[model samples]
Target: MAQVEIYDGEGDELLFTGQFDFLPRAGESIARNTDDYFHYYEVIDVWHREDSEAGRFQACLAVKIVD
Candidate 1:
């Protein structure tokens, strides 16, 4: 599994952070549900980091707001 940090594509605001089996690429879309509504985002950029810990990696994904 890999750790992922999701951020708003327009700025530095962080949206979510979690672990995933694989990293998402640019042009992919991700959705999340909140208390009142569902939100969607389009992946715009992805940055990867190789951690010192064995078999562990971290990635940052920038996503644009999507309806």
Candidate 2:
């Protein structure tokens, strides 16, 4: 599992955050902020960082608003 955070292109605003068993890959579209705007976002990039002490990996996803 991994954590996913969606933000604006400038990374100034956080759109959504959650944990997922499988993260969306680049180019995938996902509905976000459903409780508010119900906007769609496209995954732009995916990255991971190793947490040696925790013995796990953290995934970061960069996404952009599609509409």
Candidate 3:
């Protein structure tokens, strides 16, 4: 698993942050499947970081698609 941080495409708001089994690349879409609602976000950019203590992680910037 990888530590993932999902942020709004505008880079102003953070949508989600947690460990996920799947890592999405830039230009891909992520599906946020919830009990109440399901949303798809378009991945605009992705950044990876590595630290001795934190290990490897990814931060993704995405925009929500209205459908």
Candidate 4:
């Protein structure tokens, strides 16, 4: 397990940063050749509650391969 940083990489800005105990859904190859590959990813769940105008998003998923 490692701390994988999820960066948008569009405008050199950080989107959402969090600590995931396990790798994202599909994950990558253990082999050195395909080390930079990711098969699947999903936001399992999210919960937010505030005193004013709170918001919550749940089970958002995206399938993407990282290179």
**Largest TM-score belongs to which candidate?**
1
- Candidate 2: count of backbone clashes, pairs at least 3 residues apart or interchain: 0
* Per-candidate local distance difference test: 0.86, 0.76, 0.70, 0.35
Ranking by TM-score: 1, 2, 3, 4
For model 2, residues 1-67, the per-residue Cα lDDT tens digits are: 6677666656646666788878889998887566577788788877776889999877777788778
TM-score of each: 0.76, 0.67, 0.65, 0.26
Clashes of each: 0, 0, 0, 0
Better of 3 and 4 by lDDT: 3
Q: Which is better, 1 or 2, measured by lDDT?
A: 1
lDDT tens digits, residues 1-67, model 4? 3344443333433344445565554333212123575433333323222334445322212223233
Model 4 alpha-carbon miss at residue 56, Å: 33
Model 1 poorest 10 in a row by lDDT: 49-58
Between candidates 1 and 4, the TM-score winner = 1
Q: Candidate 1's residue-wise lDDT over 3-55, tens digit each?
A: 79998888879989978788889999888878888888899999976778777
Residue 6 C-alpha lDDT in model 3: 78
| Candidate 2: 10-residue stretch with minimal lDDT | 6-15
List runs of model 3 lying over 4 Å from the truth.
Answer: 49-58
Model 1 residue runs over 4 Å out of place are 49-57
Name every residue pair that clashes in candidate 1. Answer: none
